[model samples]
Target: MNILRSPPVPFTDQASVSERRSNLLDASTISPAGFAWLMLGISVSMMLCGSVTFFIGFMLMPWVIGLLMVFYVAGIVSAISLLGRSIICNALAPPSPRKHIPDNCFFCSSLGFDN
Candidate 1:
């Protein structure tokens, strides 16, 4: 009996489980009016954070633009390098297998092939 093969132990017994459920049933949940006020508070806090972020970005607009431009150029360079590597790999790869053309095919006959 290794620990990995050991059976799981119950966290709580039946009596304690029933007591906890009874306590939860006795507790009062938030009312609709309280929920509405909670939502209003959350919205106000989010708006305040958003306004602060917007002003900070606006104040550092030039630095932000420069950073964005640098990243855009790096992305373009990476894409071009990836395209070149793929093209080189394709060129170096073996030619594809020859297509099977049936002797009775009309398209092959029109192309002037005996096969």
Candidate 2:
């Protein structure tokens, strides 16, 4: 098994970011600490890989390591932000006063209007 492989995609690569985000938040993908676990795994791998490269005298530049670290930090932060978002979808939204106000006859109701 490839230890370095990223967290399994909850969505297809063909999907847009919003679609993937929604997929990640869906019931099928929701794990209380899933994102946290994935982040931890990725961060640990990054640290280990960077350390090995630096100590093994690979041609890796110090600036590259610094830039990678910055990217890693930003990635983790964005992941946390995404995990904190509400999971509500447009189709699954909570009913509101406006929702029942019947804006479109075709879409607002399933029952045929006599009028």
Candidate 3:
């Protein structure tokens, strides 16, 4: 007896091109400096939001407190998602061969390849 096969899911040409571009972007990894900048921005924003929430809570504004709580949770979720994406991108891209070199190595120094 032969097993029946399911039909393939169909996507538009535009969607196929978009999917390819998305894959390529997903495969690409950002530099350490870029990653640092992104993290710094997220951290600063989180801190600012936390401080605002604290101020509103201390001021005894119930509505503001509730709004701040919602905003804080959303921010945390977004930060976690961003971090997950960064990790996945880093994992998908191949590791640099020079990454294993010691800081004091002459080859790494001469080549300026300390990534």
| Candidate closest to the true structure, highest lDDT | 1
Q: Which candidate is the best by TM-score?
A: 1
Query: How displaced is residue 50 in candidate 3, in Å?
Result: 0.1
Per-prediction RMSD in angstroms?
Answer: 14.9, 31.5, 32.8
Sort by TM-score, best first.
1, 3, 2
Task: Give, for candidate 3, the lowest lDDT window spanning 10 residues.
Answer: 1-10
Report, for every candidate in turn, its global Cα lDDT versus the true structure: 0.77, 0.67, 0.75
RMSD of 2: 31.5
What's the TM-score of every candidate structure?
Answer: 0.37, 0.27, 0.31
- Candidates arranged by lDDT, highest first: 1, 3, 2
Q: Write the per-residue lDDT of candidate 3 for residues 20-55, one digit (tens) a residue.
A: 666555546566787778789889999999999999
Higher-scoring candidate on lDDT, 1 or 3: 1
Clashing pairs in 3: none
Q: Candidate 1 residues 4-108, lDDT tens each?
A: 233334465665766666555444355678668878988999999999999998999999899999999999999999999999999999999999767889887
Better of 2 and 3 by lDDT: 3
Q: Alpha carbon lDDT of residue 27, candidate 2? A: 36
2-64: candidate 2 lDDT, tens digit per residue: 223344484455778887766445535535477677788889999999998887766557778
